[model samples]
Target: MNSLKTVWAIAWRRFSENSAIAAEMNGRFIATVFYCTVLVPFGILSALFMDPLRIKGKPPRWLQREPVPTDMDSARRQG
Candidate 1:
């Protein structure tokens, strides 16, 4: 039918436009796939082998919290 031909023409036009953009970024697309497929696993394996808890240094300051004061006065006030 004529309607089917019109639908195919529109679909092909959109596909061609999208393919042009994809071709322009082909290198970046490959790099992203490579990083996810390779570097991400390697990094995860390295972390597992390194014993993350055994790192010999002070933890980042943001992770350190001020000790909660356990004074009897504060506890009685809340209760």
Candidate 2:
């Protein structure tokens, strides 16, 4: 579309005007693309396969944490 092209052209002009900032922005854009295309899908597949609720293996230590007391009395006692 013409609007899209115009937007891209403006962006390119700005990018060309600031080489150092453009390089940093380009790195961030690549990182975002990589995360969206690769890391996020991989994480989803890992979570699906390693269903935390199913517990096929020894669960992580964090999951075994004892509940902390939340009442005011318990907090006062601790303090």
Candidate 3:
């Protein structure tokens, strides 16, 4: 009985010491999974649908056959 108690006490002590490390590892794994499965896929889908960079807004000047006139002529003149 004393040897069993000693083993149990040692096991409890070791578990107490390592609990923080074990919790931190679990937290990091969960965060990584959330980032990969949720955040990454959401970001990709949003980028696909939303055009965050506004790449579709205007053609590059070099790509345009004719120079496009600006709608804000007064602003251009002021600049």
How would you encode candidate 2's per-residue C-alpha lDDT over 1-79 as one tens digit per residue? 9999999999999888898788899999999999999999999999778776776676566655689989999999996
Q: Which stretches of candidate 2 lie above 4 Å from their native place?
A: 1-17, 51-79
Of the two candidates 2 and 3, the one with more favorable TM-score, higher being better, is 3
- Find the candidate with the highest TM-score and give its number: 3
Q: 1-79 in candidate 1: lDDT tens per residue?
A: 9999999999999999999998879978899999999999999999767766776666655666788779999888885
Residues 6-43, model 3: lDDT tens digits = 99999999998899889999999999999999999999
In model 1, the runs with Cα more than 4 Å from the true position are 1-23, 51-79
Q: What does the lDDT read for residue 59 in candidate 2? A: 55
In candidate 2, position 55 carries an lDDT of 65
In model 3, which range of ten residues has the least summed lDDT? 61-70
Q: Which candidate, 1 or 2, would have the higher TM-score against the true structure?
A: 2
lDDT of 2 at 4: 100
CA lDDT, every prediction?
A: 0.88, 0.89, 0.88
